[model samples]
Target chain A: MHTATHSGALMAETTSTKDAEFGAWMTARQPALLRTAYLLTGDHHSAEDLVQTTLAKVYLSWDKVQKREVIDGYARRVLVNENNSVWRRAWKRRELVSDQLPERTGRHDSYDEGGSADLWAHVATLPRKQRAVIVLRYYEELSEAETAEVLGISVGTVKSQASRALATLRATAHDRLGLGEEER
Target chain B: MNHDHDDLAAQLGRQMRHEVEGLDRAPLSLADVKGRATRIRRRRAALTGAGTAAVLAIVVPMAMLAGQFTNAGDDVGPATDPPSVSPGPTEPPDQGPVVGVGESLDTADLPIGDVPAVTWLENGSVLHTADGENIRLEGTYEDVVRYDDGWLGIGGGLAVLLDADGAETGESWVTARNLATGQGGDVVLFVADGELRLHDNVDGETTVLRDGMPDTAEMIGVDDEDTAAYNLVGPQGEPFAALNRDGEETIPDPGTDAYVLNDVTEAGWVSAITQLMDDGTCSRTVAPNGDVAGETCELMFDRFSPDQRHVIAGPAYADGYGAGQLAVLPVDFTDGDDPVLELLQSGARDATLMSWGWEDDDHILVVTATPVDGSTDMTWQLVRIGLDGTVENAATPVRGDEFAFPFALTS
Candidate 1:
């Protein structure tokens, strides 16, 4: 009976330590991690899914990850890769979304709410790379090099992507920008 | 009037901040965290189980014999199969790495308008699967964008992309075959072997961002696409002049009088070029970094007139807060060329400006968010300002939890 009791205590101790470690990682990365998830899903619903999955995955390896300072980077990479994987096999379970703009970018343009949605909608039409670039760049405020490191690519690619992304955004923006137009 | 555009941009910036401020923060959930770990473990067990492996051995041969993993049931990822490094069959050497090419995920069949199927080569080079079922775009680049032009840009027109086998890839607002797509969607840039290439996505072509190499690789700028106007801040603010397509680099000429300083924040520098037509001298106020342990105050300015007489200095703050600086500066400048420098607005803590719009060069329509004490509630208030320094506050019907940060302003 005493042995069983002692063993039970050991188990509880292990659980607590694991819990503590998980909490530490969570505290450090919760803000940045959630942001990545939101950018990936483009909506809060799926972003929640992505972040949750990442946390859960990281939690399982709490003890192992606690030994490293790169836990935050590991968690973020996991979140992004997982989100991309979901879309990779999305062919089978693809849901058709409207060509209309994503109405839920949090706020609308009353002067041209109609145009804001259209811009985002066109943004939605962009390739994953383009979408990811805009989100990481504007929303998260990461640098081209940092973003490249996160996304894992060359800096040249970042430039090319920006050019294309801006061109696309410029097309939608021309009507709304109300400025001296420049010829392409 | 250059102020007209600045006013318009300021309004858009305010709105974007508001949208960001409106995002709902998810409540913390440790139980949820515990649950995820449990799920991943169980899946790993299932994948390694005797029954699963035995079935896989037989299924592989059968599928190959039958022409493919033809069944849609394969959609369920092997319980243990997530987060695995999926380097595609043909991966480009890391020498000229593709920007943001991390773990390979399943490709999507997005409608790439005019292009054929777009397949990210196992290599860094992207494969264009044209209508003829051809996979090309290989051997076309080496050290992609080596010291020259390695990245490709497809401007505003629709670009159709296909995979190696004619699968529809997603379209691009623009594609930075390498650079711009990373952190700053507004600027595609790369810094390798001491060379820095910053390109703007103003159109399909990639233009040099700021010339010169930054001490660090942090790019701080956002795609305010509407203006073909976005702001960028580089690490250490080592000023590099603009790069023209003629392959010329504008060396950073800190004219003792006019120079760029990026020491305010590690996020790089903030350069707002308000009006191109302004004969006015523009200015930026930067508070020295590391000097403020808590919150030392500073200001930023955008000069648009001459003689330091007409500059748009700010009530802006340079602190790290959820909403961009509250003490946003109102434009106050002179009409001279004698290196204009003036104090604008002091940074405020409790103030939140959601969006700002301009009725004219003089008037500003500011959208602001004010947090209520003890109420856990935030309010969005609209205020207007004039060149004559007249201020008016108005309430709008625009209020909700969905409003996001960096709410954009419109003219």
Candidate 2:
């Protein structure tokens, strides 16, 4: 939405026309947003929900992010924050029980054959924070600094978490894919 | 980067693409997203408007008033006799001007307000107004509740007891997380970090009701008998545990399939039972024996009235859709599934009902936007609405440095 504020003014005048631009931008960027969300959350349904929620938030604060460059970053931050909050609630609710087992494994079954699938599965096995860092850095191709900003953590913490995640993924690949063990 | 790790990154990126490729491109449309965003924007606008109004009404006036009083001596007025109300069945007479800032609060008549009431300023300074006099309690407290004699302020991981004079009598570092006071007794159920500590002021004693409660266990409320209801989580922290008032060691039944439990009443409990329909939320008021007392097609059943004769249920929506209005539902409604709902307040073009608290048996104190004419910027005002739909301004719009909520009323 195009909401222009006069200098030293308390209220910003909002225009409905800005939504058209925002809508167009969203339509173009949604695929990339969906991919990031999908990697962040392993489920297709959760990915859609996260994207929709993030878009809604971005649309609400569209005025503040009118500067073209900041919109994607804002949306990513919202997505990551929303995901973190959901994860916190799930953890508090104890819904992260890996042993209870899901009722349907059909959704997870599609990506089970290739080495790509093996690597993805290993990525999924990592803790939420580490997985987020790995996805933002390697998949989203965001810088370590950008990843830190997105996750609201220190650059050093992001480095350590990504390093730890990569090591775990490598070890898992050796055990599951029968890859030759490499020197650390 | 190492070649192995670089290969793994490439593989991961390919897998992520494959994952996205398998998914549906459009689960929901941009139009649908825009609509949802519009609704969310409305809510945000309402909040912002309300906040702006609060700053204008409270903050600006307080600064001016403080400036005027700086030259004068800082002397608090003497205490006066408490307002007397004969024991009978009638609503308490409107206590004259509860708490206000700036010109709204005529400092010459300071402390000349109703008694047995507690109000706090923006800076967390609590005013215990009684007998037409006020006692200023200096300190920041996260939460405060009125007890039999004084008020109990809980904050900084400690629970402190202040007497009628707003003077601290007792302080304990019990990690007082949440406190629930029941109807009559001097008993208070204090849920610590992971333990249930029951404190009785009558005997001046404190005892542990149950220790080693699951860290995830949340204390909801306590009854007159000191039986506390907790929203228990499963071993995996799934909100699948039953809403049962039990001792610490007693295992909560996981047999109930209710997804979320709402309020606990002496009669039974209300829960949002998952349904296999359009708007999958179904609310049911059930008895303690798991007997359904009444069921409704409502998204939420928020709070039960003090008398428990009615429930403060939601924004008048047909099949779970709308900005929603706060309504009062009769506790015993079996005449039909769709009964006449008593709407407490409605959302205006610029203002919306933010939240509400039961001030007394007959009055529901609502915090909502005060609609300003011809302007989108609205102010927040605490309104007390009677069961008969009578609206009265409960608190004087105090102008202060920052907006503060009338968190709780102790009377």
Residue by residue across A1-184, what tens digits does model 2's lDDT show? Answer: 2334453243422344666778788888887888889889887777887888788888878877758888888899988777765544222112211111112211111123466676787777776777888888877888989998888755655766665666676666665776543443
Q: Is the docking of candidate 2 incorrect, acceptable, medium or high quality?
A: incorrect
TM-score, chain B, model 2, is 0.56
lDDT of 2 by residue, B143-212 (tens): 5555557767665445677777767886544543345554433666665555676666677666677766
Give Cα-based local distance difference scores for all models: 0.37, 0.51
Query: Which residue window of length 10 is worst by lDDT in model 1 chain B?
Result: B287-296
| lDDT (Cα, tens digit) per residue for candidate 1, span B1-411 | 134333333433343344455355654588887786786675455433422342233222222211111122333222212222222224433332121211111112111122212112212133322122333433222112111222332212212233333233452232221222322233444443334444454443544433444332332222222111122223322222232223443322223222222111112122331111101112232211111011111333422211111223332222111223222232221122221222122333243543333333333444454444443344444444333333344323233321222122211
For candidate 1, the per-residue lDDT at B145 reads: 19
Specify the highest-DockQ model's number: 2
